[model samples]
Target: MSSAPALADDCRFDDRAGLLAMSPEAFDNGPDEGWDALAERAGCQLEIAELFTAYRQQAKAAGHAGLAWHEATMRADAGQRDPAIALMRLTYKPHGADPEGWNHYVDATIAFLDDDLPALKRARARLAKLPMPLGNAREQGDDERPAGRPQLKIVDALIRCMYQPYALASESCPEP
Candidate 1:
């Protein structure tokens, strides 16, 4: 399993513009160790769904719902289902920290995953009302942070991989 790339010597998180200025490739190629192995183990959609369901359940049982659910979404992204569905699930998490417009986003994701394109389209219409920065923002800290949301970029890369898996081999964003 390969690790996430180390920041280039020239890069610095402290500088908002510089951080945002860095090319998407810089962050897209982060570590995704063992994802291929995990995916291979779960060959079909049913296997992947079962695996993710168990993982989500366990995460909730152990009281790590927020992070665990996020991780499960990532796993779903790596599984046999449509990559777009996986990407949507991760990006459209509902009932978490900020549930404001997440319900529609989640509805769209489920509809997409279930192969109900019409439902997904309708749900997406509702999701259009949300604010610009898609997905839940990582909790901000007292210290300064980057201007761009790298995590959202991560989601973008995942969506790309769904349609072009081999081209972005190490670009998958597995849970840390």
Candidate 2:
């Protein structure tokens, strides 16, 4: 909290107009944490966390997996590591239909937040080596992704995030 964190392009949370203008679909679909990071900079995570928690519950009740992870991430940003990890383990059950690399990504994320760099590195290596999902196993942005390892950017970003707090680094992560 020394100074407000900025996005890669140096956007600061002096105001929340753009963030507030975003639709729910935009928040859920955005790969970047710009909105949440700005919210944190604006001291808005308390309200945001409540919304994510409710969304997590609905997602869990409906058997969806992603929103639980979302809540866990917010908790991690808030430095509630134990609860974050526990909620991740409890709510976001991996499905048979998920990509192999996705499982490793989850491990990487949890380990990163847990301050276990060795485990995070191992998971990143595994993710880097994973073959492209054969047919329909591609995640949303995979279609636009160049033909190569997928999701490595996110792992690298998590590593860079180690230089500072996840709350601050998440916004500044250029790879995201």
Instruction: Tell me the tens digit of each residue's lDDT in model 2 across 31-144.
Output: 554244544344444445555665544433345455566666666666677877876775433576556567777788788877888898898998888666655324445565
- Per-residue lDDT of model 1, residues 32-124, tens digit only: 321222333322323333433444443233433333333444444444345535434554444555534565745644554465667756665
Off by over 4 Å in 2: 1-41, 58-61, 91-96, 134-150, 174-176
Candidate 1 clashes between residue pairs 3 or more apart in a chain or in different chains = 3-31, 4-31
Q: Which ranges of candidate 1 are over 4 A from the true structure?
A: 1-63, 78-99, 131-176
Residue pairs in clash, model 2:
none
| Position 63, candidate 1: lDDT | 39
lDDT score, candidate 1 = 0.41
- Error (Å) of candidate 2 at residue 176 is 15
